[model samples]
Structure formats: C-alpha cells, structure tokens
Target chain A: MVLLEFSMSPLGKGESVSKYVSRSLDIIDKSGVDYRLNPMGTVLEGEWDEVMAVVKKCYMRMRKDCNRVSCSIKIDYRKGPKGRLSSKVSSVESQLKRKLKV
Target chain B: MVLLEFSMSPLGKGESVSKYVSRSLDIIDKSGVDYRLNPMGTVLEGEWDEVMAVVKKCYMRMRKDCNRVSCSIKIDYRKGPKGRLSSKVSSVESQLKRKLKV
Candidate 1:
C-alpha cells in the first residue's frame, strides 16, 4: 500500500485537485490498484513500486505551473496481523482507560 | 506507514463523501495524520494504528443510515528504500528498454 499525500498550491487555481488526482488515478485505474482520493482531494492507492516517481511528477508540474508550492509525501505500512490500528489516539474512553489504570 | 483504501458505498449520497471524509479527516487532523481526500471525496491519510476500526465505524454508520453498503480495503508498505516505487508499469519506454536490452 503506497499512500502519497502532496500538499501544495495547485498548478492552476483554475486547475482542479481532481485533475491532478486523476493523473495518479489514471495510473491506478490501469494498474488495477484500488484507490480513491480524500475529500480535499489528494490521491491514495496500492502499488508495489515507484510511487515516488508520480509524486515527483506532481511536484514538477506544480512547480512549473503554480505560483508557490510546497509538498510533503508520507508512505506507510499496513498489512498482515498488525493492520488493526492506525495509531494510539487521544480519545476520552482511551484516556479514561489509561488514567483509570494508572 | 499504513495505507488503507476503502471502496464502499458511502453512508449518505445526499450527505456527501466530503462529509464522511471529514469524519476521518477529523480524526486524522487530531492525530496530526496528514491526509487529503480524492475528488469524488474519499479519505486518505498516514497513521500507524488500528485504522480498520474507523472503517468499521463508517461501515456501521452507512449500513444503518444509508440504503446499501459494500467496502473493500487495501493496505501496503511504502516507507523505506523500497518506497521509491509504486510498481512496474507497462510503459512504452520500459517495454522499449526491455526489448532494446534484449
């Protein structure tokens, strides 16, 4: 599962996140990789190689076209027996459990 | 780094994918989990815990509130030297390279 999150000024304000997402989505669509974007509309998918190449393209396009741009990419591991949790959270119930235990 | 791809019928079509995405985004936001959604508005983020529980919630909510629901999830590893690639593609240049190399 290769997940890429690129946050930057869009190349064209008239340009859409969906369009950029589609750039990646097009790869995913053909790769038969199951994927969908976020609401603010970034791209996410599962693949086994060279996901950063796509991110690099996004950066290049945005840099060449957008006025100002900054982006970061995060890739994670989620499979097998340990796929249950995303992380430890600050939930009230969890907090209570910890505090009560303490 | 954990990647989760959930392609399920959303809870409320009239409610909006952004809304459901926002729910996950809310958790992500609090977790400092950086994420953005797809254009159609699904959720994507980076985290290192039990993400499936969240998906479980979405499923439960959609099942109760929406008409019908189906969901599939994908998780992968992309956070190391190997993270550089998503996968091999059937590109012309790559094919050309193969044939030329041969």
Candidate 2:
C-alpha cells in the first residue's frame, strides 16, 4: 500500500484556508479512496497513481482561482504491507511504551 | 534515508500552536540533523532512529505541559536512494509536464 500525506495551499489566499481546503477535500471524498484529514494535512491510502491523481486534481482545483499554489507531499510506498496507516502509529507507540490517539 | 513529515498540536491549547511547535522545532534544530519547517508541519531527514528520536523529543516536550497531544506523522523511508526531497517532486512535475514551486 502507498500512503501519501500532503498539504496544498494557495499563495496570497490569506491565512484561513478552510474554504479552499474543503473544496479540495471534496474532490478526495469523491475519489472513492480511503483518506484521513488532519490539522496538518490529508493522508491518502491507495496505489501511487491513485493517490497522485487526487493530489493533481487538488492542485488544479486550487490553481483555477489562485495564481500560485504550494504543495508539500510525503509518500510512503510499502511494497508488501497493507493497513499501514494505523500500524505505523502502533509501531511508534510500542517503541515509546505509550498509546497515541492519532 | 528517511523523511518524516509530522504535525504535533496540543489539544485544548487553543487555536494557535506556534508556541508549542516552536519548542519542538528548537529540539529538532539542536539535533544536528537536516530539517525543513513548513506551515503545516516539519520535515526531518535522516536515518530511521535519528528521525524518530526527534519526534520522540517533540512529543515528550509537548506531553510535559499538555494533557493531550495529537501528532500526525508520515514517514517516507527510501533505501539505496538519496536527495529525494527535491527529486520526488521533480518526478511528479515531469509526469504532469509542469513545474511546481515546492
């Protein structure tokens, strides 16, 4: 499974980006892929192409109105592992000997 | 190399998390490892242990003062390759036939 976390924002769109972000999330919601939206960014779980397609759509959506957009993406492409979204955190929590709410 | 993108926020600490995040960044800045600070989260680049240590320190730092802390971490562990920070985006831009400022 491949997990992607990304943050995209429009330049000169001011501080609050909830409206634009919601529009992007709307696209993701319709993509039929599993995802989680956090305060920092959105985590997408799927194949590499599936995830990147969503990101591309989001960037295009923001670019329609905003002149410049900044996107930061971190990808975890695990070849033979699935259900890593929660397992990754479990690994960390096990190491720390504490349970995380994430 | 391992690239970790994570956002940590103290729950019930109000809307702004810059202060708490600054403390976390201070720990990272002193870790002698390469890192980047963005609006959404911080990216740390290093070995697995090195990156996780910084995250542990940040979590502990926030846990000291805040009862509940939410941390969202996305890790990209690439083996036998380096300088992925820029290259990853380059690959995407190449596929899209457009350049991204990130």
The predictions' CA RMSDs to the true structure, in order, are 17.0, 15.4
Runs of candidate 2 exceeding 4 Å displacement: B1-102
Write one digit per residue (lDDT tens) for candidate 2, span A1-102: 788888787879875555676677778767887776553467788899899999999999899999989888877566776676566544444554544333
lDDT of 1 by residue, A1-102 (tens): 454443333544553343443444344334443333332224444453555665565667656656765454444434533211122122322433331100
- At residue B17, give the lDDT of candidate 2: 56
Fnat values, one per model, are: 0.03, 0.00
Query: How well does chain A score by TM in each candidate?
Result: 0.44, 0.90
Each candidate's interface RMSD, rounded to one decimal? 14.9, 12.5
Segments of candidate 1 deviating more than 4 angstroms: A1-102, B11-32, B40-49, B79-102
- Positional deviation of residue A72's Cα in model 1 after best superposition, in angstroms: 24
TM-score (second chain) of model 2: 0.86
lDDT of 2 by residue, B1-102 (tens): 888888787989875555776677667767887765543456777899998999999998899989999888877666756565555544544554554333
